[model samples]
Structures are given as C-alpha cells and as structure tokens.
Target: MIDEPEPRRQTPQELRGLVGSANIPTLLMVIYQVTRDERWLRPPYLPTRSKGLGDHDSGGLPEPVQEEIRAAGVRALLDLQDGRAPAIALPDPEQTRRMLEACVGEPVDRSYGEMFAREFRRRAGADDGPARPVRGGSDLRVLVIGAGVSGIIAAHRLERMGVSYLVVDKHDAPGGNWLDNRYPGAGVDTPSHLYSFSFAPRDWTQHFELRGELERYFADTFDRIGARPRTRFGTEVVRAEFDEGRQLWDVELRDSDGLRESISVNAIVSAVGILNRPFVPALPGLELFGGPSFHSSEWNDDLDVTGKRVAVIGSGASAMQIVPAIAPSVRGLTVFQRTPPWVAPFEKFQQPIDPGARYLLRTFPLYRTWYWLKLYWQFGDKVLDALRKDPDWPHPERAVNARNDGHREFFTQYIRDELAGREDLFGKVVPDYPPFGKRILLDNGWYRALCRPNVELVNEAVTSVVEGGVVSSSGAVHEADVLVWATGFTASRFVSSLEIIGRDGQSLREAWDDDDARAYLGVTVPGFPNLFLLGGPNSFPGSGSFMHFMEVQMRYVGRLLTCMFDLDIRAIDVRKDVFDEYAELVDRTSATTVWTHPGTDTFFRNSRGRLVFVSPFRNVEYWTRAQSAGLEDYEIVAAP
Candidate 1:
C-alpha cells in the first residue's frame, strides 16, 4: 500500500464550500467513517435510493436536511484536520456494513461487508485494510506482456512480491486500448472515480474521461510506479513455449527495429489484454475505395475531415463516440449498424466534475474513499440481479427476467426521450436484443447526433464497400469521402498474435480452438505451467471496473508465486480436473444470462454462439473467489 501522507487538506472555508456541494449520502458516510459518529447513520441523515444511473448529489433529501448533514459533516471533517483530532480507524465489519447500507439507501448483504471494507481506498492513514503477506526472492523471473493497465498493475504487484520481472509492449508507451483507440470522443462508459487504480488516485476533471486524458493517466501511472526502468517499450512477444524439463518459458520477442531476442523466465503473464487486435471486416470491394479509410482504433490524427463526407461502419462504443464528435464538423456522416447496442443514460457524460465536488475529492481523503466506494457499488454487482435469467418469465424473447424487463423498459424510455421528435431514428438506434445482451454503451450525444440534418443512421448491415461509400444489404449505397470502421476488436480471441506452446506441444490456439477460449478463474491453464493469463477469457465482469478485476487477479497471482517460491516448486500447473470444473461452472452460469440469448450477435460469443468472453459470475463473487490462490488446485513440479 502507498504510505504517503493523507491527501492535502483544504482551507476551512474551502472545505465548507466543497462539503456544501458534495453528495449528502457520501458526506454522511465520510463523517461516520472519520469520527465514529452514529448520528450520521440515523433517520434524518440517511439517504434515499438514488435511482437510475445518476449520481444523485443531493441524495434526494430536502434542502434543509441536506444542509444540516453537510454542516455536521463539515464540522467533523474540520476537527479531523490539523492536530486537533486524529483520523479515526474504520469501524468493525458490521458497522461498516451498516454504513454502506445506509449510504446506498438499501441493504448490503452481510457477506460482502468484509470485502467492502477491504476495497475501501488504500490511501495513507486509512487503516481499513489487512497487511499483505509479502513473498518473493527465488529463482522466479517473470515476463509481463503489454504495458497497458493490467501490465502496469502486474509490474506493481510483482515488485511488492519482490519478484524479478520485465514488461514488454508493442507500443512505444503504455495505455493499451487507451493508447490504441484514439478515435474522436472515445472515453470511458464507467465513472472516472472507480475506473482508476486504487493506489494511484487522480483528481480527474470529468466523470467519464476521454481517451487523451485516460492515456495520459496510464503513461503517467507507468512512470509514477517506476515501471519504465523495468519495461521494454516497442517490443512484441512473438512466441512463448513451455520447457518441460526446465519448467521455464522460452520466450521470443521482436522489437520495433525488427531485432529479435530470446529469454527464459519462470512465469509469463499475458497482460496483452482482450482487446488488442483490431478486426477489419473482409468485404467486397473494400480495397477499391479511392478515398482515405481506417478503423476507429487506428484513427488518422492528421487526416482531418473538416467538411468531408464520412461513413462510420459500426454502431458500438467507438462509433457512438466518433459519430457525435465528427458530426458538427464533417460535411455529412453516415452510421451503419449490424445490430444496435443498449445505450444507458449517462448524465455526466463529457460533463466536467463541479469545482466544489472536485475540491471535496481532492482535499478530503475519507471523502474521496467513500465517494469512490459509492460509485463502485452503483456500477457493480447491484445491476447483476437484472441479468439473471428466470425460466418462468413469459417474455423471454425481450428480457431474461422480470428485473431484466424493467431494465429494458428503463433503457427503451431513455432512447425514446433522447429521440423524441426524431421518431425516424428510434427504429435505427434501438436494438432487438435483450438488455445486457451485449456491451451496453453510455449515451454521449450518440442519439442526439443521429437527429442532426447531416447525420444519417442506417440500420442495415454493410454488404460491401464501393469506390466512394458503403453498400448496405438493402442494396442502398451511402456515399462518403472517408470511412471509419468502428467494427470493434478480436476480443474473444484471447492473447492474439502470440503463439503459446504448452506441454505436450499443445498450442494455446489449439486448446481454445480459435475463439472458444476458457480459463480457470480467467487465469491459468492446465498444461501451461507458470503461464498466468491476466484479464483472461470469461473473467470479464459484465459490470464494474476492469481495473479492480485486474487488481484482484494480480494479487491472486502474487499468492501463487509466493507459494511456488516458499515451497521451492519448479512449476505449478493448474490441475486439469480443476480447470475443467471451473470451465463447466462458467458455461453453466452463462446459460442463465442474456449473453447466451439465441441469435443475438456479440463479441461476447464465439463461433458456436457460446458466451466465451464474459464471466458468468458477479463482480463480488469473482473478487471473493480470487482472494487467495491455493496450491492444491495445481500440479506442483519439484525443483531439481
């Protein structure tokens, strides 16, 4: 944990001003956490449930009641500052659970109380966490692939474990998808407060940060964590083969300069992330297009389309952002959709964090932690219940369950409201699939952009490309001077490009059989000993931050490495039975979710329409399961 001082304090006047504008619920939680005050948890101070996805800054409380809580909270916070009052230790688990329930204005399960407590911000002076058992120093040397978010996180955990490691990425710098996907208006659909690393907090300006700022956060984080010295930029992993006798991975890497190098390490972490390779569809006459064309991931920064006609051939996340960003400037914009996505209402999309709110987050450590925790709960497992399938539900065609139907209604109304007078655009924008059937996008003027006179939304699948435009399956040609393919990535194809040759010369590609990838807890494979997969298949949480998921996985990896070092084990291969059982569990649970809904096309599914990409488990379930790595689940090889 970072042992720096508590975040810098603001002037008393500034604190009052910031507290005045802060969320009453979060402020009340902070007050209770800081001063051990039971009053904040009582009747008048308790918050009402903030419905939908909005922040509910006022906590649905009357102005006088909010002011009263703010006044009391500010006083407690002021006392905690300077030397007058000490930062109070976090209360016991039950109390913490009560505080969480009170803040969210709903019941927080007793089981998740401890997990909630641990995930509380790890800033200095916050003694809410248990001390981690440090383990390292052996013959272990790790090769971490990709310097993206997961890779950076891997390096940090490795350092904490005292393990020797090297980070390699094809890009000259860090920021994986953030680095590669630089399309206009590209930003996070998740809240900024929870999207970032728990250890390295930023006083982010916006709730959902754009690509440039998010990219900078990663690059800056890479440097701040001292990963640069241990990282080899512009290096790509060509192949990694397991050496049966030596219990090491023989890795080959190619540099940007075309130089090749070979190395052997005790373990290999494929931090290469799920969404690395861009998938450009092979269409009829795509090469015949005379004008400039490129995928959204490979955006042409210098090729400005100030007045040029542009065709965006995808209706996913990237297109949602790009169509709106270029709409005002482009002479004409045409969006082609194979299938529409469920777009949720994001009130804070592209909106700046208020100056007062920013001050509260920046100045108060407890306030930041509590506020962040609130976002985590909102964006996380609270929504998982809606995705659960109910066989008894009559309208299985539209939603998985009654709760799921409610979500569909909410999202449908949101779309209708956004498309109000432009009813023509509604049919083109709304999806036929059930809610949460695929990745749900957040509306950042996507619906509004379609209403523009120059913007045309085409619901037909793009049949081909011609000299000047895209040809839809309806045989209509949409003309354009430029084409932006936001066709997404080879997401289900885990650890793409790099060939992994496991024991018995079984290739990872052969095991996955091209897109049917499975991992035991989205980590290790049976034959690939000491080869850990970070952000592996079926580990994708349907909701919550990927950053949080990666953190827990890395921690589990550290524990496994610690076991290996302490036991003098040469290699620990995940037992075949254990892996199979886990995979079976994943498949069984997946059948109960909307991702497995028949005929709904998504990157979440593989060739046979199996849900291979996303995890069937809730985010909390994964966090609880991955808390510790046990050697019993693996076949341990002894050192020579």
Candidate 2:
C-alpha cells in the first residue's frame, strides 16, 4: 500500500477560483444557516453594511485572513454534516423577525417571519411531503391559457391540490416569452439563482444565464413535474365567456390548423404574460420596406446578417442586449434612440459561473438557499428609498432628492468612466431623469459597442421607413439591409386579444375603457366572478425578481381555489368596495414614486397616465398580502 496523499490545502484565491468573488458572503451565510453561530455573522466574513448605501465598502481584508475564515467555515460544514457538530434549532418567530430586519436594514412586518420560515423549510427540502388533495376538487376543472412561467406554476399548484386542469399554449412548447424570443443575446438581467423558482433550485452555469439556458430550465421543470402530458401545444385561447346561470366559463380555442373548439370549465386563469404581444411602432411606409423587418421578439434566424448593414430601432433592455451581440458581425450598425436608459455597471453581467461554484450549488446542502437569501437582501428593497419622491426637494429635474441625486451621480460617473476617451457619446448615452424613473438596465458592453467605428448612435426621431432604410426628423435617411424593431409591448392592454365576457355580458375591455386597468391585488376584479389573472395589471414588482411575485400569486390563487371547493362555493367575486379601496391605495402609493415624476414617460404608465404595469409595494409587502386567501374580501355565492 502506498503512503496516503497529503490532504489538499486550498488558499483564498484558490477557493475564490472555485466559487466567485461575489459568492464569498453566500458561503459564510450557508454556514450560519446550518450552525446558527453568531461568529459566522461578523465582519470580513458576512457583509455588515447594506448595498446602495454609501457605507458599503468591502473593508479590503487581507487575502490570508479571508482564506483562514473560509477554511474554518468549510471545516465547520464538514463537521456538522459528519455528526461531529450539533445542528442548531430553527429561528423562533421573534428571532426571524429581527434577523430579516437586520438583513434588509429595514423594519419588516411580523407576518413576513411566518412566510420566511415556510420558505426556509421548503428550500431545505424539509417540507416535501405530498400535497393533501382538496376534498371536493375532483369535480372542478380549470383552464389555464399560455404555458409560460405563470401558466406552468398555476398548473403545478393546481395539480398538487388535485384540481383537474388543462394548459393551452400557442407555441409548440412550454416556454412562453422564452420560447418566442430567440433574439441575439436574449437572457435575464437578474442573477441566475434568484431568477429561478424557490422550490426548484438549478445549478446555473452563468451568473446571468442566456435565453437558451433559461428556456431549458423551464422545459426541464415542466417535464420533471409531469406537466407535459397535461399541456396542449400550438393551441390558443381565442375567447372565454362566463355563463352566469351555470356559474361556469365557456372558452373557445384555435389549433395550429385554424380549427376551433370550445370547452366549459369552472374557472379560468389568464397567464398570457404582459410581454407576449410585440408592439411594432406605426411608422409611415412600414409596409413598403423591401428589407427583412421584424420585432426583436420575433427574431428570424434564417436571414443572415453576416456582413449586411443592420438598422436597430429602440434602446430599451432588448436593444441593449442586441446591440453588443450583433455589432461585431454586421458590416455596419445604426441604432436609433428616443430616450437613453440608465445602465448600471455589473461586473459579472457577462461572466459565466465557475465550475467549482456550480459543483457547490449542486452538491452542498443549504448553499443555494443561502445564496438566494443573500441576493434577496442585496437586491430586494435596498434601493426602495431612492424611488420615493421627496416632497420638498428643490431639484426635480436632475433627481428627486439628495439620495436619488447621489445614485444619479454614481451611475453617471460609471458611464463617464466607461466612456472616458469617447466624450462625444457621453451626453447621448446618459439620461436626464432620476434613477428608477424607468426600468434600470444592466450594462453588457453597450457603451463600448456604441464607441465602435462600425456602429452609429443616432438620437434623432425616426420619421418613417423608406424603400431602402429609415428617415429621421432631421431630413436624413439611414440605409440598411435589415431593420429590427425593439419597441416594447403594449403592456397597458391587458388581455386585449382575448374577448373575455364577464357577468351580464360585460367585456373586460369595455370595463377598463381607455386602458385604465385595475384589479383586486392584481388577481381578481369586481364583475369577473370565478375568474383570475396571472401576471395581471399592476402585479409586477417595482423591485426584485418577477419570478418571486409569480410564485406568491400562484400560491394565493391555489388557496382560493381550495377554499372555494371546500366551502361548496360556486362563484366568488371580489367586493366592489374592496376593489376600489385597494385600487385607490395603489394609485396613492404610485403617485409618490419616481415612475410618476413630471419628466418621466415610461411604459409602466398607461394611456390615462396611471401606473398600471408595475405594483407600488416592496417584495415583502406583496408576499405578506398574498400569504393567505382573504375569504372576507369576496362575496361568496352558494352552489346551485
């Protein structure tokens, strides 16, 4: 027998090479969650300061010290798993409240502690018991439109509760926007770990995954949960009518061959997310263009743009991603901008996850959960204070208040540094409005792309599309062989394509005339009985990952369905007064945010100048509100 090899000793740099620099705090947090030792929560190991605040310095600890701390933490984990160290008790209600408060640097409502504990158990795999099917759910059925994230989630929860349901998607597969959008550099801006479902943790290969990876995640999730057989692909819901007498919904569907069929169900869930519909701007002579023209969402891979001149219109999130991707290959690129977006600098925006980190996420216990929690605290409400409009602030043009001004200065400096030598593009790239006035975009070498010699950034308004190219308001025409429309969706038009008739033959569109959309907690409406909306109006969070909001909404909807079946209720409509009260609160809260400021004009607002696309509450607030089904808020009718 040969002598045993010496145990490998890893240095701080070596460990970081395995994990990432941004994941150091996450590793320590995993140890803290497992051991509940306060020693793991001290400085140099865990972050003592919050992000977005001026005090968020890294302290620049010595590399050797960091190595020692990580080594000890690793040893502790091993000992705990090997039964050498005792497992600590879970945090009590009060302790959880204080912990969340400290983690977020804000006072959290006590109700969130319960939510936190439930989530903790679920992520820890301690709560994987089979769902106790509702007693009366066998007789009920649901029709979920669109097999996207929201639709998949709705189906999963419904099936777990033993409810009979069917999912219909227009695409050939389960991924919704993910399936439809195959544009270049299509991916998520949120961190990959936090962007995923809490129950289904994935070992993402990139810090911010691309479109293919995200699409695969959804498809795999669908297959794993056995939702594939229950879903009808290439099927679209054309219309749905509520039969008041029978208390059921008659839904019309169209297949790929244009054949129509109708089915009756007890309830309906509209999950055709807000971004499904592509909005191509109505420019003169658009139909007369001879070149290949399409929206960014409707990307055509067949047409090769290897060396052809390409014209890209719009400078929003999608355009930001597209410009940097296609700039290198195109013979020349012309980008038209209406308003410059504030691009925040994130070093890991384009970096892939380390193999060692992926191994830890897949192999280690509680590592992914701890990593999610760290991201939640860092990105959750850290910048919420900056979005609030300071009533007495004098400078409204530059920023809303002193704190907002500070953020503007920081972001501006980042832009300045990124474009240091290219001073000509500075004024053209920076926005004049306050931060969060529009959706914040992550930088993916956008400025660098704009500085390329083959790329041209035009700030003029596009008048129309001519025979060979686009005409600007300055009487100049830019020629191109390909034209791309990155103009975003008509988000205010909720369920516009579907003709949903509610009680007494009232159309949903007629009720919300002029696109003034409103709903009760973004799930139910007053006249729409036995109907629910997923990714509905004002349901999107102003901050944090949108997947978190969808999970909360689906859970709440599941509880409502369970309660209805258990109570023998045929129809449940939200009280008119209750809907009014909630809508008023939403309006009041939205008025105080930067989204409604004078100088801002964003897609978040509707035609009537109301903030209908995004919710005004923090992530915690929404989670607390959607934690339970408020039976008292509805008018329940007994089954006929």
Best-fitting candidate, scored by lDDT = 1
Runs in model 1 deviating more than 4 A are: 1-11, 83-88, 121-139
Q: How do the residues 113-210 of candidate 2 rate in per-residue lDDT, one tens digit apiece?
A: 77666666666667732488997888888998988889888888887889888999999988899987888999998888878876677878888999
Encode model 1's per-residue lDDT on 23-68: one tens digit a residue.
8888888777767767778888788987777788888888999988
The TM-score values for the models, in the order shown, are: 0.96, 0.93
lDDT of each: 0.83, 0.79
